[model samples]
Target: MDLQYVNFFAVAVLAAVIGVTLIVVHLSQRKLRAELTQLREELALWQKAGLHAPRAVAAAEPDARPSQAQGAPMAPAPQPLSEEQIRERLQQAAGAGEAPERYRHVVTLADKGLAPEEIARVLQVSSAEAQQLVRLAEVGRKKS
Candidate 1:
């Protein structure tokens, strides 16, 4: 009778372990299925919104006209200022009594294609202040 009881207890423990394992596996599968369904729904919504699909026109077409001559060399675009023109403008600005020597470096930096942030770093000023200096230089040039 004791042997019979030990055998039954062993079976019961095994059954309990199997039941717990099955429950865990079932819960994991259920979670995965739910996530897959949610992802599928989102994919469908994206398709309906035309966000997931490519358009009929894949890319813009190029211009039909020939851009260059068959044998002739291409000419460069005209610069905003020649060396002489720049000197004349600077002389004129000085004569007209613009901001003194202190601000000339700011204009030179701007003319060299340095951004306002970089100019600010070089001049030890805020970007906004540097931009103001650039604007003043532009207005001065326009006036000249």
Candidate 2:
């Protein structure tokens, strides 16, 4: 084949690949956006029904742990955490820029008297990290 023809073919192939990739990305983003919107709507419903925490978190109380350890069923429902309370906790979390936002949220929830497990569930963090943040918050409180 002529050099110019070979170059044209390669460019055409590259353009086709780019086009396919852009289409794939666009479709993936659309799917993700739809899923996110659905989740947000479900969250709004749950909030309206006064169910902020999961059933598992309801059984995470210090007094409730013993029953769970013995294979008892979880609590009927978690305490109703109002939207205003969540907003207040987030506002407190926003006050400190010394740590990452996730860490700050964890500490704020801990300070608000939420258990490590509850904080983990609310913030979508690992339980171990939430426990550490809670302990860190405790130490900070003691120092002040």
Candidate 3:
């Protein structure tokens, strides 16, 4: 191909890539918005019903090892964790810096005593990510 033709092709390819990227981003935003709407509905229901925490949930077992892990000592599930216990678990899971605003929100929720799993659900992030955010938030808190 002529050098001029090659340059034109490259520019066209770049434009196509940018267009595809924009479409993908728009779709992702729409999906996230839908998730947010669903979360709001759930929150409203929870508020209207005056929901309370169950007596015991997995949050209590901070040190409890998974039953199926190799060579790990399996422990019985502990009783339900107190608000403080849950908050601590969430905070301990946090770290610092990648997404300060998001992590800050995670920390706030953790302080409100939401379990890591619950925070994960509401935020549409994985439980591991939620934990990490909490840890980051704690580290930031200590520094400031």
Candidate 3 residue pairs that clash: 56-80, 93-135, 94-134, 94-135, 94-136, 95-135, 95-136, 96-136
| Error at 29, model 2, angstroms | 0.8
TM-scores, each model vs. reference: 0.34, 0.40, 0.37
lDDT of 2 by residue, 1-144 (tens): 799999999999999999999999999999999999977875675465455633445565545333556886654443444555544544565475444545556665666678887876765545666766676555555545
Give the whole-model CA lDDT for all candidates, comma-separated: 0.64, 0.64, 0.63
- lDDT by residue (1-144, candidate 1, tens digit) is 699999999999999999999999999999999999977875565465444422122242323223455553544533355455656656676887865543676776688787776665555455666776676677668865
- Return the lDDT, model 2, position 66: 39
Candidate 2 lowest-lDDT run of ten: 74-83
**Listing every candidate in turn, what is its Cα RMSD in Å to the true structure after a full C-alpha superposition?**
19.3, 14.7, 16.7
- Better-scoring candidate (TM-score), 1 or 3: 3
Superposed on all Cα atoms, model 3 deviates from the true structure by an RMSD in Å of 16.7
Worst 10-residue lDDT window for candidate 3 reads 49-58
TM-score winner among the candidates?
A: 2
TM-score of 2: 0.40
Model 3 stretches astray by more than 4 angstroms? 52-144
Backbone clashes, each candidate: 0, 0, 8
lDDT of 2 at 50: 54
